[model samples]
Target: MAPTKPLLLDGSTGEGGGQLVRLAVALSAVTGQPIRIVNIRANRTRSRPVGKRGSVHVTGGGLKNQHVAAIKCLADATRAETTGLSAGSATLTFTPTLPPSRLPRRPLKIVPESDASSAMLIFQAVLPFLLFADVEEGQGVEVEIHGGTNTSWSLNYEYMDLVLLPTLEARFGVRVERELRRRGWSQGPAASGCVWVKVYPVRKGESITPLQLPIPLGKERDTRGPRDHFEVESVDVALVVPLRLLEPLQTALARDIAGVFPSAPEIDFRVVEDSGHQARIYVLLVAKSPTGLRWGRDVLHSPPKGSSANPTSMADALSRLAVKQLVEEVDSRGAVDVYLQDQLVCFQALAAGRSSFARHGDGRGGGVDVDGVAGAPGPTPDIEGDGLRREKTHEPFGHGSMHTKTARWVAAQLLPGVQFFNKGDVVEGAGIRFA
Candidate 1:
């Protein structure tokens, strides 16, 4: 059936990040609506050639060059196809041929083996449509995406499993069943992977209420170095490789984490074999937060330089790097913590009423409160609270005034609010709401 509300998505939203594709696809699946996208990744990269001759423009140039060709939807699908993409400059256009009401029985198909990055981009563009198919129509959405699963520019399968899936499930209540039919890595033998998404719409009773600022209370602990004390709900590491390479990878990861946080308990690691040629690694970290559950993923591959030495070393380094980045962002006193802040937009939008996140003047304030308990505060506290002797101590929660300039702008556009603050407690508007 034709969708009632047509969501016109700007290809360049959220710091002009490709997330516009990701969110748009996911939302389409949930809402079962057809969306039109123009100027897709319009600002991504400039047209340039690797050398003086045989030079090809980047993403934009490629699109312009393909404009004159016989552009057609690939097999009644939402994606467009054109050969000689790098032949010349052209203007490309996209229009959804099939409405939600007229969607075919067959699952959506996207075929593009040469530019895995473009394939991934297309997936994000169409993912939302699939996700909402079942929920809106009470039927499952089957998707067969053909492209590089482990390409440098695309999201590795490991990250999809370890990080992205878990976050969606925990925060937004999304359930997806997937199978790795084949493995495809960058500049290697290509293969395919299948993902089945089952979305259960929130029951009337299960709807989440909007939260307000100073969302209260929780004790916090440092989980960084060895012997550091912090409670972890779960930690799972999965590497895409053969059994022979699994053990060494696991050992290296554990040792690395131990070196960073000795006091933390042993983390669990799992290995899944991939049929493709290239190797990849994905890590998922989950912990209880004051507000709810916090989840993070690190998807990376080994640098090509050391391919000859230790196969798993690259995986280990990537895992460690992902963890370090997450911890650092969470520990910062900035207005919005990076990943969580970004992922929270969907939840905030889906919320029944209203919700607010604490804004740290600098990314250095104490941890936020869940209900009434407080986590560690940032380096310097701006507001003063009561001291043990009844004197006023510094308080981080309400130190600064509510500056909703950016948030209001987003809210005005019917989008989520995103705020930013720097080290000197100077609040500034950020283009990407979540960083």
Candidate 2:
């Protein structure tokens, strides 16, 4: 086959890293457009921990194992053709035998090489393409991935369970059934861990539906409605720890939340005897809003034996991290949480129709004589001709919406027509069809 007029990509583009490669390849597979990615993961470099098991340094700077795993896994599952798919390779050319529109009839499976490699990362790459797949007549895509479930530096498994799956299902009508046979943390007692998930597409050709923004953003002269504030309906927590330690941790978290949330929001705590690994504790917190927005945060660690550890301190930190993050996300008044904002950019772009969403701003109506700023922060909400400035502290986490801007830059690079603006966020494929 002559080259497929590949969509060109630079690994070092804005938010330059593995996600760009993962997303480009996923789009390639779904659109059946052969992809050519250079400078693959150009901006990402990590030092391999001096492993006690003699794991050595990763010398070259290029595609990481997880990126390779995501591509190869999806390709193999679909019997796709490819080249330049080796560890640390700076370029990749991938051609799927059939795009996701014409998915094969079977459950696709992916297993990474290292027990420490992240399952969530691989899932990010696989999911977009999978959304367009149908395993049987009228059935959605079915897939199973076995690898690191809660590895460090990647979104943990529960975030998908608490935030992503529910949001996709409710907002987009995507159906999925997930099962976690085993859980894996980066440095736990078990050499490796696993999670199993199955995704059903929104339809055969389209995997995702366009996002419905709470408020539309197209006209500068338009009147504004009251912004949708994410209200916490409840908080559900899961702890994987030694069964004996559950009660103390639960009691401590309950007390902390009572003080943190003076409103006394409903809280549910569940404990699992297994930490999914040999670790003594892994805590997951899921806070859901009445309108279905969600924010999740978790912490997992394998403490040294008999150290100067206080159960009170550990429990306090874990619970505080979870509840506190949820507070920040909800306070931002964003339709989605901070972490979800970045990843959703790709899905919005891939939708078969125009997709729009509310991109949260700091709500300052105007800022310091903003002029001709092509990508300037939005004007303050509900303010006109007032020279009042709401002081912003240097603390970056105060607003909690970070990477959505970087996500916009990435979208501009990969898909020329897609616009991720403050208002009227849209992704249109221009009627291009692949099957």
Candidate 3:
């Protein structure tokens, strides 16, 4: 007889922003647990037509169609509709088609209509599941995500490369091969982009040894200009639009990048003319990392009125803003440092051994904090056999093993035999772990 699969419940699957969906899908893939969600994107506005005539042309339509296993409600209707998901903006219900026993059963297939945000979210949801899928010694999984490569409300290719990909590879030991087939943008449906991701899983999980984060190298000065060591090499800008709007976007971005990085020789930008009505801009910022971080950002707004000097003025503005943010974070000493703190959590759990991170106890005086206490014996009986045991402690604890402490009271949870600590001291999860 087949074993009964445990159901993983996501309280806010659709709540908050897209994070809920992304996290749920990622964790589901990691834990090999099937999930059923009731309120998908409950906080988001229902799908709406991008242009006039109530014609649905947005990527949300693609999402609604692709995941037919999940049912959604119209804002006003009592019954859910598989067809015409645009009846009215309403809540979505997602139920996985297969059980955990059947996951990674086949490479997941998703075809999004040039909607980068939706496509990325779908990718986040399914990628983790694929990573954990059962593969032979040398088998790799492939997923084809179709959408606008450069779309508003989505992390352009640059961020996926620099920020997202680097962090994932470093922390989770996940290696992926990606190829961008075509470019899609929000100028209209005319700009279509395709990308394929090949995922290779780390079978034994990350090394159990503790990690030691290196201090960031200081800023460097070059003959061309004085820039942060983490400075963006060049932004590969692409605008997918009608022939008329093409020149306008190019001129605008060139001007903007010149202003931002005046000393740099010139901004390396490009344009792809595919569809006339739709226009999207894709910017890939080449970083100076050994593995060359690729950060992508795009502008998917409507064409500007009165070509007066700057036709793609809005696109220029948004792109410049994104570049500024990316530069600031990459250059700042604190950005990657903060991320390292958060990312270590998953690795700690996977290590099946205690791991530590260098962090200040009270926001002062840096020290190493032991994150996972799995090796320590006998706080209680082994409950799940996932190396997780609960223990009753005289301190405050947070959900899952994260904790904080105060002098007044000791708050924590004892899950049979699990042990938690903070600053080399035992603490509880009363507030730190839960909200």
The estimated TM-scores of all candidates read: 0.59, 0.78, 0.55
What is the model-wide C-alpha lDDT for candidate 1? 0.41
Best by TM-score: 2
Q: Which ten residues in a row have the lowest lDDT in candidate 2?
A: 391-400
List the lowest-lDDT window of 10 residues for candidate 3: 406-415
Global CA lDDT computed for model 2: 0.61
The root-mean-square deviation over C-alpha atoms between each candidate and the true structure, in angstroms, is 10.0, 7.6, 10.9
lDDT of 1 by residue, 1-435 (tens): 343444454544333334443454333333334445445555566656576676655653223211111122221443322222332323222334343334455655555434333333444445433433323334555666555556564556655666555555543455566665555555444444443333333332244333222322333443432221123334556656534456666667667656654336456665445423444443444332333334454544533533665556655665577677656644543333334444444444434432333435455433443221121222223332222111111111132222222222222232322222221122111121100
Cα lDDT, model 1, residue 287: 31
lDDT of 2 by residue, 1-435 (tens): 234566666666655677667777876676566778888766666566575755454533687777878999778755677779988789888877665656677766777777777888898888877776655556655567777777777877777777677777665565678777777767656455566777766543433554342222434443543323254557788777755457667987777767765446688774445563335467777776543456666776666766565666766666677667656655655555557767776766655454433444663311223222211123324323233233221111212243455445444545554433223233343323333
Q: In model 1, where do residues sit more than 4 Å from their true spots?
A: 1-14, 21-39, 46-106, 113-124, 130-139, 200-230, 241-245, 272-292, 305-323, 329-337, 340-344, 355-362, 365-435
Error of 1 at 304 (Å): 3.0
- In candidate 3, residue 232 scores what lDDT? 47
Off by over 4 Å in 2: 1-3, 48-61, 77-79, 135-138, 205-207, 211-228, 276-280, 304-306, 352-403, 413-417, 423-435
